[model samples]
Target chain A: MPLPSDIEKSFAASLLDKDGRVPSDLTSYSSPVPQSRFNIYRNNVHVALIDMMAAKFPIVLKLVGEEFFRGAARVYIRANPPTSAMTINYGKGFPGFLENFEHVQDVPYLADVARLEWLRMEAYNAADRKSLGGEDLAAIDHDRLIETSFELHPSLRLLQSEYPVYSIWQANIDGVALSSVDLNSGGEDVLIIRPRLEVLVIKLASGHCDFVRALGSGIALGEANERAFESHEGFDLQLAISGLIGCGAFTGFSK
Target chain B: MTNLSSWLDKPIPARAGVGLKPEHFAEILDTEPDIGWFEVHAENYMGDGGPPHHFLSLIRERYPLSIHGVGLSIGGEGALDAEHLKRLKTVVDRYSPGLFSEHLAWSTHGDIFYSDLLPLPYNEATLETVVAHIDQVQDVVGRQMLLENPATYVTFKSSDMAEIDFLREIVARTGCGLLLDVNNVYVAGTNHDYSPQAYLDAFPFEHVGEIHLAGHAEARDDAGARVLIDAHDRALVDDVWALYERVISSGVSVPTLIEWDNDVPSWARLFSEAQKADRILKGAQTEDAVAV
Candidate 1:
C-alpha cells in the first residue's frame, strides 16, 4: 500500500512527462476518462507555471514571441520547478537556461536580456535603504576616505555582457521605434539598482563598471580607483564617482 | 510564541472585504472605501521592503486584514518547508492579521512548487498527512490556521471518506477553523455531480472563521461533462451568489472575501461585488434580529 505521499510524487512525475501515464493505484474514472481528468491537473500545472514565467520575463516572451517562448518555458519549467513558494523568484535559473537552450541559440543576446530582467526583478524586491549623497562622502576625513570601502545598496546588481543587452531591453520595453543595433559594437556593462521605489537600469562606461564592480566586491576606495584607471585610459574619477552618487548606488561606507 | 488573542489584535468584522491588489493601492488610499477588511496573498509581501510593504502598512492601519496563503502545500506528503514557515511567521508577526488561511490542496512536492492549488484525494492516508501538516503549522505560527476547501477536478476511487467527513475529522483532530470558500463548493459540486447545497448543509459552519467568494470559468470535460474551473478571473455567477446568500442566511456571519486574482476589474466594480455581499449579510442580520 503506497502512502499518499507516494501517490502524490508519482502524480507530480506524471504531470511533468507528457508521455507518462497516470498511476494505476490512483483511481479516478475508468481508463481513458481518468486520463482526460488527470490531464486537467497536468494542464493546470503547466499553464500556471508558464504564466508565472511569462509574468517574470515579459520582455523575453516579447523577444521570442508567445509560441516559441512558451515552448522554451515548458522545457525550463520541467527542468527547474520552483523550490520556493515565492513566484517572484521563479525564474532565477531561466537566464542560464536560455544561455544553453538550443532553440533560441540564433538570438545570442536573448540570455543576457533575460539576465537583465531577472536582475530588475530582484532589485525591485530588495530591502529598502537610505542612499548616501556626495556630502556624506565629503564628510569623511580625506585621509580616512582612501582606506574606506563603501557599501552598495542591497538592490544593486552589476552585469557585463558581450552583447548590447541594455539597448535590447530598452528597445523592447520602451517601444522606442526599433532602430538597428550593432552586435559588433562591443559589449554593455549594465548597472541595476533601486534607490527608492523605482528600479533604474543604467548603462555604464567600462572604467566606471570596473570601479563600481570593485566597490561592490568590498575593495578599498583607493584600490578600486586604481583598478578603474587601469581598465580604461583617461578615466575621470570625479565624473564616475559623482555619477555613482547620483544613482544612489552606495548606501554607506566604513574605514 | 504569541498568544492567540494578542496575535490577532484586530479581529475581522463579520462583513464584506476585498483582496488587495497593487493597481488599486492609490485608489484605495484615496477613496478609503467602506470595505470591512482586506486580504492579501502572503507570498506577495515576503520580500524585505518595497511598495508592497509601504502600501500594506497604510492599509493595515485602517482595515482589519486576513493573510491568505496559496503556497503552504499543507497536503504535501513531505514535511512543511521550515524556511517558508519562518517567512510566513515574519509576515504574521508584522501584520498581525485577524485571520490566516491556506487551501487544503497541495502546491508543492519535494522541492518543486506548483503555483496553483492542486487537489488531493479524500482518503485516510491523505487525511492523516493533512492533519499532521496542519498541526505543525498551528504549532509554528502559534495561532489557529483555517484550511479552505479545494475545488477539485477529479475524485479518487481509492478514497474511503467523503470530502465533508474528511474535513470534519481534520477539524476534530487539529482544532483548526475552516475558511469556507463557497465558490469552491459550487465548482467542485458541479464537477462531481453532487448538490452544492448539501455540502453547505453538512459543513461545520460553527467552526468557520472566514468565507471566500470568487468567480470561476465553466467548460466541458472530454466526457461531455460540465466542468467548472476555479479561475478567479471574472464576476460571480448568479448560482454562486445564490449559494452565498443561502450560507449567510444560515445564521453564520463570517468575514467574507471577494477574490478576483485575474482579469481584475476596476476598484469600483470589485467594490460593487463586496457591497452586494454586504447587503446579503445585512439582510441576514436583520432576519436574525427579528427571530431573536
Candidate 2:
C-alpha cells in the first residue's frame, strides 16, 4: 500500500505550481462550499507571497503602480517562491525579474531602483560592527594610514548602475514627484551603509566609487588612492578618505 | 549575542500579549505598554544584525517574549532547511524567550518554500514525519516547541485520525507541548463544518503552553457557505472572544497573544486588543481566587 507521505507527495507537488492541478482526491468529496476546495490553498499561497513581495519592494511598486506591480509580482512569485524559510530575505531576485520582464522595458530604470531598494533592505538588517570615523583615522600616523588596508563595514553595499537609479529611488522614497528624477542626467554610483541604526544611501563623487571599490578588493589605502587617481581627473585622495570616513563606510584598518 | 549564562528563566504569566511590529518600535520603547508579554516571528530577527536586534535586545530586558516560528514548517515532508534551522538557532540563543512555537502546517517542499501555511492530511506517515521533525527541532534549539494546530479549509480522505488525536499522539511521542490558537479553532471549524466546542473539548489543555487569538477574514465557499480565513489583519471578533472566555473559564490561565500581522493597527489599538484578552484572563483569575 502507498504510504501516507507517498499520497501527500502528490498533494505537495502541485501545491504551489501555477498551472498544476490541486490533489482533488484528498479534499472532501462533499465540501459544502461549491468551489474546488483546493482553490483555497492556491489563493492563499499566491495572495500572501505576492503581498510580501509588494511590501519589500515599495519603490518598485510605486514606479510600476499598484495594479501593474501586483500583476508582475504574482507572476514573479509563482515562478520564484522563496527558497529559504527566512522570508525577510525573499524577493532578492525581483530586480532581475523586472529587468527581463517585457512589459516594464519602457521603465528601464525600475530594475536598478529595485536593486537599490533590495540593498537598502539588506543594509537595514545586516550585522553590526564598529565603523571608522575621521577621528579614528586622524589618530593613526600619516605614513601608517596611507599603507594600512581598510575594512568595509558589514552593512556596506555599492552599486554602479547604468541609470539615474539613485535619483529615481530617492524621489520615490521622499514621496517627491517622479518628475524630479531627470533620467537623461545619466547613471550613478550609489553607496549604502548602516553603521548604526539609520541606513544611508549616498550618491558618490567622481572616481570616489573607484576608490571605494579598490579598497573593497583588499587593496591597501595608498594603492587604492593610486588606482583612483589614475582613473579619473581631480580624484582627491583626502576628499575621498574624508567622505568615506564621515559616512561610516570602513571599520578598523590594519597596517 | 546576549549573556546566556546570566539569563533568567522567566516564564510567561497568564496575561495577554501582542505581536511586536517595527512601526511601533519607538512607541514601545518610549512608552512601555502595560501588556503581559510580546511575541515576534522568529524569522524577523534571523538576519545578521540591525534595528531589529537593537530594539529586540532592549525589549527583552523588560518583557517576557515568545518566539513564534512561522516558517519552520514542522509539517514539512523534506528534511528541514539546515540554513533556516541555523538561523532559527541564532534567534533562539539571542533571546531565551519564555516560549517558542511553530505551526502544524508545512510551508516548504523540495527546494521551494511556500510562505503560507499549507494543510496536511492526518495519517501514519505524516504523524511519524511530524513527530520526528519536532524531536529534531527540540534537540537543535535545546528547548521544547509548542505545536499550534492549523486553520484548515479542507480534510483529507487518507486521514486515519482526528486533528486533536494526531496532536495528542505527537505530544505523547515527542514530549512536545501545544499552543492552542483559539481563532484557528473557530476558523477551521466553520470552514470544515465542524464544531469548535468539540475540537476545544478534545484539546489536550494540560499540554498547552500558551494561547493565540487573532481576527480572521470571512469569505464564502462556492456554495456560499461561510469560510473563515485566518487573516490576522483585524481585531478579534466577538465569537472568537467568547470561545476564549470559555477556555479561560475552564480554569486555564495560559499566556495569550493578540496577533495582528497585516494592516497592523496603531500601538494603542493593538495594545487595547491585548488588553481585551487580559480582561478575560483577569476575570477568570479573580473567580478562581474567590473559589479558592
Candidate 3:
C-alpha cells in the first residue's frame, strides 16, 4: 500500500503532467475514466500553483520571457516543491535554482536578477519598522559608538553579487527600453534596504561593502570598521557611517 | 457563551471587501478604505506572531475580517489533517473572523501537502470523506465552517452524485453553510460544457452564507483546445459579475466578498470592485423592501 504522503505527492505531480493518473494504490474500485476525472482536478491544481508562482515572481518572469519562464517554473515546481503550507514564500530558493540551472547559465546575471527580485518581495512583506533618521544616530556619542551594535531596519536586506544585478533588474522592468547590458562589467555590491517606506537598492562604495555587510551581520562599529579596512584598504569610515546613518539602515544602537 | 457567540458571529455588514494581500498591508493601515471587511488566506496567518499578526490586529480594529482557507482539502479520502486543524483553530480564535470558509477540495496526505486545492470525485466515498472532514474542522474550530464549491475541469465516470447533490448532502450531514463562488460556477460550467445558470439553479441558496467573485485565465490544451483557468484576482470578468447578479436576485443576500488574490491592484481598484458588489446588493435590498 502506498503511504498517503506518496499518494498526495503523486497526485500533485500528475496535475503538472498530462497523464492525470492518481497513484494506483489510492483506488481499489474498478472505475474506468479515473484518469479523466483526475485530469480535471489536476489541471485546476496545476494552474493554480503556476499562477501563484507567477504572482510571486513577476519580475523574474518578465526578465526571462513568459514562455521560457513558465517552462522553467514548471521544472522548478516539480524539483523544489513547496514545503510550507503558506505558499506565499514557496519560491524562496528559486534564485539559487536559476543560478545553477544549466539552460539559464548563458545569462550569467539572470540568477542575480532573480535574487534582486526576491529581495524586493522579501522587503515588501517584511515587518514594518519605524526607520530612524540622522537625528537618532547623532545622539550616540563617539566614545560609546565603538561598543555599540547597530540594528538594521526591519526591511533592510543585503544582496551582494558578482554581477550587476541592479542594472539587469532595471533593464527588464516595464516601460524601460530593453538595452544591451554588458555582463563583463565588474560586479556591484548592492545594499537593498528599505530606509523608509519605500525599498531602495543603492550601489555600495567598494570599500564599504565589507563594512555594511559586517554591520548587517551584527558586528559592532569598531569590529566592522576593522573588517572593512582589512578587505578594502583605506575604506572611508566617515563616508560609510554617514551613508548608513542617512539611509535609516540602523534602527537603533546597542550599548 | 457571550464570547463564543460573539466570536462565531460578528455583524457581517453588506459592504465590499478585499482579500488581504501582503502588498497592501501598509496602504490598508495608512489609508483605511471604506471596505466592509478584509479576507485573508487562513493558511497565511498560521505562522506564530510577527508582521501578519501586527498588521492584521491593526486592520481588525478598523474593519471586519474573514478567514478564507485554501488548504483544508475537505473532500479528500484521507482523514482530516489534525495539525492543520489545530493551526487553523489558533488563527480563528485569534482573529474571530466574521466569516470562516475553506474550499470543498483536498490538498494533502500526512506529511505531504500538495499546496494546491485538488478536487474530489462527487461520489458516495467522497461524500463520506467530506462530511468527516467538515465535522473534524467544526469540532476543532468550534463553529460551522462554510465550504466553497470547487471549479472543476473534468468529471468522473463512476461518480454517482451531481455537484449540487454532493454539496446539499454535505450541508445536511455537517450543518455547515455553503460559500457560493459564482466565478467558480461559471468557470467550471464553461469548462465542462454545462450551463452556469443551471448550476446556480441547483445550488442550495438557502444554505449559502457567503459569495465569491474573482477573475480567471485561459489556457490551450495539448489538443489545441481552449480551457478556462480560474486565475483568482486578475479582474472581475464579466461572466462572474453576471452570475453574481443572478445569485443575489435569487435572494441569497449574505456577506459577499470580492476575492482578488493574484496580481492584486491598488486599494482604490479593489474597493471599487467591492463597491460594485455593494451597489448590486443595495439595489436588491431596496427592491425587496419595496415589494414587501
Instruction: Please tell me which predicted candidate would have the highest DockQ against the true structure.
Output: 2
Q: All candidates' TM-scores?
A: 0.96, 0.96, 0.78
Clashing pairs in 1: none
C-alpha positional error of residue B282 in candidate 1 after TM-score superposition, expressed in Å: 1.4
Candidate 1 residues B47-164, lDDT tens each? 9887889899999998899999889999887888898998898998899999999889888887888777877778888888999999888888888899999998777656778999
How much lDDT does each candidate structure score? 0.88, 0.86, 0.76
**Candidate 1 vs candidate 2, lDDT winner:** 1
Model 2: lDDT of residue B211: 97
Interface CA root-mean-square deviation for model 3: 6.5
Tens digits of per-residue lDDT for model 2, A1-255: 455566557666666666557565465524532245567777778888888888789988888899999899988987888888888889999999999999999998888989999999999989999987777777778768668888899899999888888888888888999897788998899999998999999998888889998999889888998888898878998888788888898897875
Q: Candidate 3 chain B — worst ten consecutive residues by lDDT sum?
A: B1-10
How much does each candidate deviate from the true structure in C-alpha RMSD?
1.7, 2.4, 5.1
Best by lDDT: 1
How close to the true structure is residue B253 of candidate 1, measured as C-alpha lDDT?
Answer: 96
Model 2 CA lDDT for position B68 = 94
* Predicted candidate 3, C-alpha RMSD: 5.1
For candidate 2, the per-residue lDDT at B115 reads 80
